[model samples]
Target: MKHIPVLLDAVKDAIGDMRGLRIADCTFGAGGYSRAFLDAGAHVVAFDRDPHVANDANMFQNKYGNTFRFVPETFSHIGEIDGLFDVIVFDLGISSMQIDVGERGFSFRADAPLDMRMSGKGMTAAELIAKSSVDELATILRDYGDVKKANIIARAAKEKLPQTTFELRDLVFNPNDVAPVFQALRIAVNDEFGEIQRALAAVPNKLACGGRCICVTFHSLEDRIVKNTFRDWTTPPGDARLPETCPAPFKLLKTVTPDDGELENNPRARSAHMRGVIKTC
Candidate 1:
């Protein structure tokens, strides 16, 4: 299936007139955001850790020439990308390509190796399950997945560490818990929360004065991180228990969600949320 960019129009609106702007497409999943930015005459520096999207990045480079550049790296290291950007957009979580492939182990629909690494490196989901203690697994499920029966699932999963998607799914009897458990495993395997923290911390330094930062998050965990980080950026130091009334560096923008039209066409966008902030200092 073709990967549709979620909240496409809203993202474009947040970036405003992109002509002559330097933008960073932080996730660079399928190059959707980058393509849009390039089409609007912006110079886009796109980053992605997944080697699977290299071809897509190459296509963008060929199509946009000097107007586009791709970096095979994670957004956590976005700070290393010399110079500030007029706008930075991060579409977080697994791309549609990953989930639809079945072999990527992002979805429980097919029996595949329990590999959830976006970069195809690091420990696999199976390894995570095998090594984590019941307490650790419970915490991952509860915090990342918000699964109510986290302890029960963790105990079952620990008895026989699932080597494949189907094996993992079998542990959760309730169909509703399957998705959350899978999500927790994926998040744990990818160290997603840690990466988000790192990326958010580095974002302010990479944004130029009056630059805009836009983030698209699918699940609540990721959305909360984006929301809280933006909140900190918008809050005065005095309110945060600091000595002086140090003003925030960015002004929060309106949050956006998919409309009925977008939702009807793309069911995957149902959980998507988009938030933006503009640098003030």
Candidate 2:
């Protein structure tokens, strides 16, 4: 299946006119947002940890010349980029390309090696299962996947670390539980939550004054992080000891979801939630 960016129109609307703006496309999955930003006359520096996207990045460099750059790094290290950007967009989570390929082991639908590394590095999902204690596995399932039967599933998964996706899927008899289980393992293996936290911490400093930060999150775990961080930035600094005159660094813009048309065209977009905020200080 072709990769479709979730909430593309909403993201463009949030950023407004991009002419002469420097934009950071943090996820750079299929170069979808980067392509759009370039088309709008924005100089885009796109980041993607996945090495497989090098070909696409090369194509962009060839076509856009000096207007575009591709960084082979994770968004968590976006702080390394020199200067601030007028706009920063993060489309978080695994890409469609990763999930569609069975060998990547992101989806339970395909029977392949149980590897779910986003950067194609680090410990594989099968290795995580093999090494983690039942308690650790249970915590991962509950926290990342929100799986209700986390304890039971962890115990089952621990009996034998499934070397393949089908083996893991078969361990969980309920059809409904398969997806969440796989998702939980994938997130743990990829350190996705930690990456997001680090990226969020680094974003405010990287955004220029009056700049916008937009995030497209696919799950509640990610959405909550973005929502709370944005809220904290916008909140007035006050306490029993602190002064009310302290200013906020950013102002909340708005949060939106895909419209009916977008949902119909891209069913994968259903879970997407977008949040936008502008730097004030």
Candidate 3:
């Protein structure tokens, strides 16, 4: 199945011209954006932390030849790529590819191991929950998921954890309703916010003059950091004292929401948002 790229029109508009452009796709889950850019005649280098994505690179190569390249590495280390580009696009957070894999345990609906690592490394979400105290789980759920049921969920999770995904779901998640607690554990496991902030701050320094970076964020915490980073980058040296609402270095290219058609076709795209910026330098 083709992984639907969220905010396609917005991405194309924000991406602008791509001919002969050197572009970096920071989150290259399904190579949707990378393929799109390459089709537009840009030289696209894409990154995905998941090793599994590399296997899919064969599809891009068979179709697009050298136009698309997938580097299996986290965006945090993507900065090591030399020089700037005409455009850098980041489609942040869990891809449909990962969630689709039943073995990865990203979905609460799926019965699998408790793992949620994007890189397939480190402690699985199951392991974390099993080891965490109620307070720890509560903090993770509240801060990561922005969940109001953190206390209740934590208390419930305390009863059983470090088990399979099914066990965790059975204990804390309401089978009738989706679990925000699961989302929280996934976010925590991935260190999503930290990865985002580091990438956001570093990209400006990596950009060439007038290079653009478009970010597609799915969650509020990631969205907030991107919003603030853009503001800070565009803000004047003395503007730090000003309130948060004031616009600063980069202009608000636009906040793109999914159209009804796209949302209807792919429910996962509902929470997706696109923000684009042009480098002031």
Q: Model 3 — which ten-residue stretch has the worst lDDT? A: 241-250
Rank by lDDT (best first): 1, 2, 3
Q: TM-score for each prediction?
A: 0.96, 0.96, 0.91
Q: List runs of model 1 lying over 4 Å from the truth.
A: 241-248
Off by over 4 Å in 3: 62-66, 173-178, 241-248
Clashing residue pairs for model 3: 234-248, 234-249, 234-250, 235-249
- Candidate 2 regions with alpha-carbon error over 4 angstroms: 238-248
lDDT of 2 by residue, 174-251 (tens): 788889998889889989889988888888788888999999999998899889878777775553322232234577
- lDDT against the true structure, each candidate: 0.89, 0.89, 0.80
Per-residue lDDT value at 83 in model 1: 92
Question: What are the per-model numbers of colliding residue pairs?
Answer: 0, 0, 4
In model 1, what is the error at residue 120, expressed in angstroms?
0.4
lDDT of model 1, residue 104:
89
lDDT of 1 by residue, 107-215 (tens): 8998999898899999999999889999999999999999988999999999988999999999898999999999998999999999988888888778888999999
